[model samples]
Target chain A: GAGVSQSPRYKVAKRGQDVALRCDPISGHVSLFWYQQALGQGPEFLTYFQNEAQLDKSGLPSDRFFAERPEGSVSTLKIQRTQQEDSAVYLCASSLNSYNEQFFGPGTRLTVL
Target chain B: AQSVSQHNHHVILSEAASLELGCNYSYGGTVNLFWYVQYPGQHLQLLLKYFSGDPLVKGIKGFEAEFIKSKFSFNLRKPSVQWSDTAEYFCAVVSGTYKYIFGTGTRLKVLA
Candidate 1:
């Protein structure tokens, strides 16, 4: 794809339900990232992947948050026992290198009730 | 701990008005600074970035930013704003361990 793409543009889940967000990064991009954007706030880093390796996940807020880039091109972010506070826009970004320009996806807006 | 700070949460300006958005980060090291804009219902687009060389960086859509290392600041400026410029702007810095930290963001509303 020319740009990064995410699935389920919007998701509404009941509290305690588990939800998964997917991301398809640009072709052959070596670095991928996930971020959480609260309403009226900037995106916060959640995780990073260098190819298939999950190198950095220090920003994941809790155990409920888990992200994987199994094939090194597509990634999934799964949140277990979703809480009201988990309601936010989940963004995915990809870059050719670790500290270069990042191409972003439209993001998935999750609403937990 | 390193963090990015955006001075304004929301700003309103008339078309043709000059604009300036302030951004600051707390880190004393070599870093890469960037400015991104998100228009309504759109993904983030890079406005400009400063890795090295000149401190003043020019971006698309007549936008520019200045990187002041002493103040740890990268402020975005435009001589004249258009109604189309209304969007949310983000300031980010990539420092140690290749982590990208972002400010809270500034929402700009340009009224015609």
Candidate 2:
């Protein structure tokens, strides 16, 4: 597809288990972002990558959360020791550049039990 | 802490009603403002944006927004709304970096 796409539209994880969510941004997009959206709330910024370089990750909630875009096209967000609070929609967005409007993917909804 | 604020959490309106959703940001520097909408079971999509030049920006689905620098506000408006306009609207601000600070969002319900 031409738009951003994500895998496993839904995931349920047990406490202490680890989960990995994948994001495939639009082709040729130089800016990719990650966000977390809780029920009844807007998406919150998590991290951003300019190409292969992870530029800013100030919004990441914990050290256990890690994101990487080694090839600059596909990114992964991994969460270790899943907790109830970790249940939320993980959204990925990609833009032509840092200054352009981002196109989003149907987020992967993660549920921690 | 710099953040975006949306005035209403829920808005109930009838078809053909005029709509206005408020959004405000606490920032002093030059910034980019955007309004995004997410329909039921759909991804978030950009409605409009304000970077420079004219403050009034028109977006998809007959939606528009005005950027008021002095008030630090960018409110979305639609003259006549239809039932299809029902969705969750988010106001976001980007001061620097590529990341966006989004508001809690306003859920609008347009009744037919």
Candidate 3:
């Protein structure tokens, strides 16, 4: 079975640019999560979605960060006006349910210059 | 605020040596604990988890973790680590909330 997967393994963008990272969760997964991992740091939860409903977005750092999971399958994390501070790896994970073990993706590394 | 702590930042050991990594969390309630491993160039994968029942839980690759509620700790252990075990290990805790609070992670280098 295919695990969670993220597209554009690497991305480079200038400051003030907008970037979108996509995630494809495993088939039949009902829960999806987004996290940000800075250099030498653990992943920090950014948002969570149950099916097509966004359950939590409190972890998003600022208004520039947005995420959506329509159709209950694919999810996207978009950062507007990219900043140097936003340079980090974006990880996506999915689980059968909220309590089940999550399967992680390879992550998309974004660099803002 | 819920947070997880991994005291060891890095560890180096020889193959077949015993390994133990410390993980502690600050949350005042029932919690679920998990250990995840990320091999170089690979995605993070689950090593084990502790939800309830026995405090000692065994995971894949001869790994195990002990959840001690009194200490607010869940330490991962392996009696004999292999060279292939070199990877970054993360400890995460889920409290009443559904999101996971992860530790900074410990990078282990196993010498063959």
Highest DockQ: which candidate?
Answer: 3
lDDT of each: 0.95, 0.95, 0.97
- CA error at residue B76 for candidate 3, angstroms: 0.2
Task: Write the residue-wise lDDT of candidate 2 on B1-112 in tens digits.
Answer: 7889998999999999999999999998999999999999899999999989999999999999999999999999999999999999999999976778899999999999
Return the candidate ranking by DockQ, descending.
Answer: 3, 2, 1
* Cα lDDT of model 2 by residue, A59-107, tens digit: 8999989999999999999999999999999999999998899999999
Instruction: Give a tens-digit lDDT track for model 1, residues A1-113.
Output: 78999999999999999999999999989999999999888888899999999999988999999999888889999999999999999999999988778989999999999
Error of 2 at A50 (Å): 1.5
Runs in model 1 deviating more than 4 A are: none
- Candidate 1's displacement at residue A78, Å, is 0.7
| Interface RMSD values for all candidates | 1.1, 0.9, 0.6
Q: How good is model 2 by TM-score?
A: 0.98
Clashing residue pairs, backbone N/CA/C < 3 A, model 3: none
lDDT of 3 at B85: 99
Sort order, TM-score high to low: 3, 2, 1
Writing each residue's lDDT as its tens digit, candidate 3 over B21-110 gives 999999979999999999999999999999899999999999999999999999999999999999999999999767999999999999
Model 2 root-mean-square deviation: 0.9
Candidate 2: residue B5 lDDT (0-100):
91
